[model samples]
Target: MNELFTRIVSGVIYAAAIILALWSGKLATNILFIIFGLICLFELQNLLNFKNYVSYFVFPIALIFFNYFNVNDEITFLFIIACLFVKLLLLRDLFSLKGRNAFRQKKHLITLMYIVPSMVFLTLIPKLYPDYNTYILLYVFILMWINDSFAFLIGKHFGKQKLFAKISPKKTVEGFLAGFTFTIIGGILISYFNQTLSFYNWVVVGILVSVFGNLGDLVQSKFKRKALVKDSGKIMPGHGGVFDRMDSIIFSSTFVFGFLFVINHVS
Candidate 1:
């Protein structure tokens, strides 16, 4: 079928980009991040109707974070918090609109708040784990992939209990538990082989990813529902869009970056 072929082509493109960014240094990685950030931002703006001011701020902020100069994790974290404060202050009047229009206009920025920073985190992975960043990133991606793939296959075959029927009907409790299990197994297996990461750390990594990744998925799902759109974009065939594709990785990558940062510093 055309749909199946489209999905295959899209998958190949997606995989190639991810691998390229992962293997490449911070500069190349940030290039990819900026591109993705722009794409996601545009989609959010169109889909959710964010104000121009918010988009204006997020654009330059994302650039600064991706810069070579912004390598410090602490600085980046503070920058993210500062952005939140800016949003709170700048949008106070909009927030007080007390009607659907305000939230509607702000929805785009809200989504950017999560999407942009996560992309930066992806860019930061290389910076934080300078020596073994690629391998560590590999570990994170593998677990996320395993979690999603297994969840979809297992859930389709035997998905009885809806995990969040209100938000994502296709998701089921059985699928989620299966995803959690596979993520743990994948994490341990990958991290053990790498030697740079410990087994206990891998376990914690697995737990954090499963928790955060699903939350990210749910967050996107809520956004999609609120925005009244099924897919974020039409670029990918079966994947829907960038956000649709990177939904889980967004949160998982951030967690992995932070986790490795702590470990890399402590050890």
Candidate 2:
């Protein structure tokens, strides 16, 4: 019952924050993500046991500049490429026999390379979209939530095969497919209200979130397994930590940003 109450309260707060931020416009959204980035950084640092105040100070300053400056597409593209490369390296480490030590040895570098750029791209979404549409950002979050919620429900009831037992034992193939299916549905529904993105584009977004979002969760699970902790932090009751909550968004935001970047350039 206590756990149930915590989940409900946390869900309400999380939903409210996302909706309010979306309704408040671009600046508020930017500020909210900046705060999210910092909290995630803090949680990650704790998980990795790497105590560095540099990121704490640098992230906000860098975010402020990125938000204020008229950053060119080339730079944004380069950042996305860097983020992808780092993610690939992380994936490689995840699969390797020595994955655990490799991650610990390079925690700081990974934090700088992976976490920083992901947050930057996440903050860039609203700015990149037409009219600085906050709905685009909101749509991403909504799809993520929908995918996560349904995946758990379907997986708990009917999951048979493990998706990646080593990294995340609880995840199952059935759950993944269920999440992917519903995310596509959620995306199409969101498209009806948000005409800025076509139905096809929203479906594409759904695919990205369903695939990469799960990967993100697994990536964090690896981190937690290594750290021998259940969650990253206790910032959000029943939700683990800021890092736990934002892992999917952090991991998947780059792809979303990349898509938007290409769309903007071609159109």
Summing lDDT over every window of 10 consecutive residues in candidate 2, give the lowest-scoring window: 94-103
lDDT of all predictions: 0.71, 0.85
| TM-score against native, each model | 0.82, 0.95
Model 1: per-residue lDDT, tens digit, 1-267? Answer: 787788778977987897887687555666676777777776656666554457546765766646546456577667556544433432343334444443355554465565667667666665665452666666777788788888887898999999988778999999999999999998888775876678888888888788778877876676677789899898788889887888788756666666766787788
Which lDDT tens digits does candidate 2 get at residues 50-163? Answer: 887788777787677777888776787787898898787777777777535656888777778777888878777888766777778888999999999899889989999999
**Cα shift from native, residue 69, model 1 (Å):** 1.6
Question: Model 2, clash count?
Answer: 0
Candidate 1 Cα lDDT to native: 0.71
Query: Candidate 1's error at 159, in angstroms?
Result: 0.6
